[model samples]
Target: MESDNKQPCQTALYEEEETLARLTKTANFQGASGINQQSLNFRKDQMCDSPAERILKQLHNKQLLIVNPKRRNGIILYKRYHAEFAGPGSAVGVSLDTDCQKILPVGNLDLISPESADDRQRAYLIRRQWVRLTLQITENPEPIGRAQKIIEQFEGFFDSATIAKLPDEAFSLLVGVLPHTVAKVRGKR
Candidate 1:
């Protein structure tokens, strides 16, 4: 169970959507001095005018967008996925959720064993796959439940099939059903 803190620029971009809206409307971002302090602000020295400014920088660095903001196409999440590998001896495999990349106060639920050779081998394949899973709520331990559900679901479609055993189509299928179920995300609220 983890959440992504990988792309700060991405984080900034989404978080600053409202600010960007204001900036686009007014074509101005004077930072802390501006009336929209609730959504936008400038730190001391002000290396950049806004989060949008930094997002542009990151986009350019990644070559996802051009240097010109006037003609720039914003970065879009074309695809989102959780990294996973077949956990040996279990019908379910280990996965790293797009959200779970940090070690928060999430409860104890260790699915991967360090002692097992297969576990170590799987982990060694992708060290950055999972950092931790934090549940946030002490009373509600739903995160663990969520993880278990993911494993259970994965096992439904795939069982003990190593990456090699799976077909080319399997990857695409996994993309649809992730370590965290997608139905809850795209389903009716």
Candidate 2:
């Protein structure tokens, strides 16, 4: 009967609306920037498991992730007051230093385990990559030295145009330098 068909159609439309509302809620919770503010808001006791906790657990497990160059799989590990960019060719989830921070994978990170790496990639991993190198250089005694050295190190790896594209705030956060100091150093180049 027509009534039976109409009832089914109404049920289908209602289900579709519920599904859409759930998706929208998830999207709103995650946000456009990719950081899960919802997870950040919850205390350890209140939340059983979260995406952020999983990332920290992976870091603690010493699982290394290489940023996929083709996708520009960039990640920003940030605390409430600081942030650092881990770009392509950089390793993540390797250092325990990220324990207190949140990992925001900017785009879909094509992460592969080290066991999957070939000989060339293995050799590349042997060298001190971006995050490690940044931490080391930022230990400089003088503030100006910290800023200049980070800029210099980045220049050695990335071309001027590429380096120019990165935000000054990221560079400054890694080295404990002011954003203006990074600008001054970049201007000198």
Candidate 3:
């Protein structure tokens, strides 16, 4: 029985290698040995800011945070009554209708990851940089549709259980909908 599973795993691995080889050929990717250390260092310096630094810069600039898609990190922005959840590839703060990016008192957000507790703690220390995005849904012709679009954007990156943890109030606050309305749309899930 174990060998049966192993056989399929081996076949999948081989297929993956073949696909990678074809991609490399098509992209003209020279092997790792061809890249010099100076080029690698320059690229790293340009693109690899410490995670905390990146978060700070985004919030400070009031830039809609486009979370790194390759990472599993998620962030939550908490207000007095609600908290917004943003997963990878989702924009967390700032919206078109409003320029409210207040992050007063700094304990308003948390970055979560499946990694070690140390990483979670590190994120907490950087919570002061967290910014809240205020979106005005009433201005939209279809308020409910606007709310649903916001909900779906979050749903795209998080699992059902993760979504469940976020209160209806959070979603409502995000898109300026009633909690009950958020519940109604969520039920349609």
For candidate 1, give the lDDT of residue 181.
36
Candidate 2 lDDT, tens digit per residue, 51-151?
44555555566656555444434556665576666666555665533453666554444444444557336525633465577778877878789988877
Superposed by TM-score, candidate 2 places the C-alpha of residue 176 at a distance from the truth, in angstroms, of 0.5
TM-score of 2: 0.46
- Give per-residue CA lDDT, model 1, range 1-189, as digits (tens): 123222322332443455556664553545435455544334221334444344334333332211111211112121234333322222112232223221111111112224456654544443322212111111234544444344344445333442224332233223433322333432312
Which residues of candidate 3, in runs, are more than 4 Å off?
1-70, 80-139
Clashes of each: 10, 0, 0
Please give the lDDT score for candidate 1. 0.31
Better of 1 and 3 by lDDT: 3
Model 1: how far residue 113 lies from native, Å = 30
TM-score of each: 0.18, 0.46, 0.36
Ranking by lDDT: 2, 3, 1
Model 3 lDDT tens row, 1-189: 222222211221233346545544544565545555465555445345543444444455554434333444455554445444454434444341023332211112232222455544443333322323224333566657757876776666555666777777666766667888888887844
User: lDDT values of the candidates?
Assistant: 0.31, 0.57, 0.47
